[model samples]
Target: MGYQFETEKVVDFILKNSVKKVLIQLPEGLKPYGVGLAKEIEEKAGVTAYVSADPCYGACDLPIQEAEILNVDLIIHYGHSEILKEAQKRIKILYVEAKSNLDIGKVVEKSLPFLKEYRNIGLVATVQHVHKLEEAKKILEKNGKKVFIGSASGLVKYDGQVLGCDCSTAEKIKDKVEVFLYIGGGIFHPLGVFYTTKKPVITVDPYTKKILNIKEIGEKFLKRRNTIIAKFSQAKNVGVLVGLKFGQSNPQLAEKICMKYLKMIRKKELEIILTKLQPNPNPKILLEQYSTPPEIAANLLYMATYSFNDIVGKTVCDLGCGSGRLAIGAAYLGAKEVVGIDLDLAAIQTAKTNSRMVGVKVEWVVGDIEVLTGKFDTVIQNPPFGVKKHGADLKFLRKALSLANTVYSIHKSGEKNRRFIEKTVTKNLCGRITTMVETNLVIPYLFNFHKKPKYRVKVDIYRIVKK
Candidate 1:
């Protein structure tokens, strides 16, 4: 009677009915994961089984044709609460709720108070949890609440069909409701709640039978979710830091370089001082604010080579100078004063802490370089390589021209047109300049399922003094 299938009752019906063959109806959209469940049922029940090819409502509906084709006496359905009228009499439908990681009963109970507060609410969940969605919605309705179930078209059949999140369905109904109640096994089931509407979102975990903290789940969810705006922001002049040795992502390394550049910009804005932490095998590693990977000593050296610092003692500017590696290198080479800038407050703070290690006074600030103004005798920096996140190499060059007497910057060498960059800088810069091209030293590393070469670098040191 209820949405949940009682195992004993289903088994009793199957045994008593002299079921010679069994048919399993899985939602067309949920078939990929349902195939495994069907195999288990056949092995456990010792019965011949058939799976319906017919499209279904969350795997709840099956064609009467399947019963005739398989000649099965019983059919077990996965992930749907309703059966089509056509299949009702021909097939003995045993609707078993797909197991969820959350406790459904407790989730419903905990959400009663919230549901009662809103007269009308929108309900949504992922395909895996759709079986319990109707029942959950009904419970809210029974408590004097109105529920509108989102209409989600079944998954597409094409190979290229990108399975979009169910949130789009929720978005359609957002304006019609005062609040949204997401009933599913886990917070993942109701991600649509975050984007669909500004209405307060309540997530019920059917497996835990509890109402969870939506804010906590949302925060973690957003951290992993990639956005187009963020991508563009990172694409400006980002650098990704990958390890030269082993077990690292090449693309990730490129991103790290970008983060370092941004951190340098932030440091300038906040006027935070920077210090270099000890450079051991593992430098105090953390992803920059823009999601660049850890900056290793090898990366620092690569940046140094790319930075093209001329004879030391020239006042140098290190834009987005994370940990002051390039700045310190310039200082060590005899640059008079080294200035490092970054956008990350933490990196600037740590840079100040590590400045002692460099044994040099490097001025690090937390700010964006687009707004900073100053003059330096030379500018040495490793601008981000803008593969994953945007980089600010252009901004660095522009800033260098505006604030310094000469500029030396490192960037990805393999980008589409290396010559165009030289032209851009030459065109925008105030005076005569020289460019030196060099390939980024290739580093090999393992990450996830892929291994790749990391090298996209061209270092340019330009001299521009007021004519």
Candidate 2:
């Protein structure tokens, strides 16, 4: 009741976009207002609105597949700010943060009695009440207490805001503050703050006018976790459960857990692991988003890992890393750090999901090769063949050479093209082509112009070393 749903903005968006059918998704706390909002949309915008009964944890838990199944043109998701910017391209989602307008002076006054022992207090709140943190800070400072609010980073949108998973704001100011004052309703955020900072946390629920200390809850959670760990340590066999949800899926962590028990993994096994990775859902023609085949990726990584000894325990970068096959393969092959850079956000998102599915860690960036900077031990890339866009391969080669001493790049195979590439790398790029391996690149039907189910094009993989 204290939250603003922004009903007028939702109606205006629907009318402007000509969204005939829309789905309304709300958190459990905000579900009570769903029917009224839907009614308003139907009356004002003249659009059919259906309220989803499914529980939403955060902005990451988007019911995009459900919306797609219902064939809705747009989804109005309430109670959270937008976290998954990539998902918007798949389904049009409008996020209403549902900012609360409740006065917190009474709650802050109530919390002062419990805060008498502490001088320096760190202030934080959920996005709903993040705006009220200054008011709470003023209240605390007036009572002869120092208040500090951490600046925003990553998932934290506001200066004093904290997400259920991200309590960085509290952690950032934990050293300066003796205790944390969380101005939100639930123990979920406060618990995160307590665990992350290991500082005493006091929660002031503005709605209920209740005060709570979360140190005891955090202690109990730790005890439970340690007990589970103790039991798990005794077990000989353990099964990994992968979360299939967009927000819940964490295959990268699961992979790490599994790898802890494994001995030296072979190239064949790495290839098999990579084969299970999900391909880019949306590939652009201009970018030539042809994902490297599993066998080719494995072969390239094997050459770097086994033959050249460049990948293992070394930093690697994948230039124009489409769906992150090459970069992920390098990480799988024991690269200390792997970075995958791409211009397409959609491709980067798919690459992230694929890395999670394979249980490997890779720094995925949504940007062009020109944006990439830093030195790496090795660089691997499958750049455009200069077909749709002329001289695309030269751009990738030049960028790769600048980033790493050793570069493995793929280009269209031909006597004329190979000679041109060799001269370009040697003369202009200040690099020498050490080895050139001719391989067949299998291109599956992606664009509308493709005539066959699949076709093979001869391509040359050049291993260039900086002179």
- Top TM-score hit: 2
Worst 10 residues of 2 by lDDT: 226-235
Candidate 2 overall Cα lDDT vs. reference? Answer: 0.86
Give the alpha carbon lDDT tens digit for every residue of 1-467 in model 2.
Answer: 67888888988898889899999999888899999999988999998899999888888888888888899999999988877888888988999999998999998999998999999999999889999988988899999999999999998789989887788888888999999999988898899898899899999998899999988788778655544443343234568999677767889999997886455455567778878878889888888889898877876776666556789999999988988889988988789999999999988998999898878999999887899888999999999988889989889989998999999888889999988998899799999776666678899999899999999998876678897
Give the root-mean-square deviation of each candidate in angstroms: 19.6, 22.4
Encode model 1's per-residue lDDT on 153-236: one tens digit a residue.
Answer: 444221111123335566767788887776555554455466446466787765456675475566455533422222223232
Each prediction's TM-score versus the true structure: 0.33, 0.56
Clashes of each: 82, 0
Best by lDDT: 2
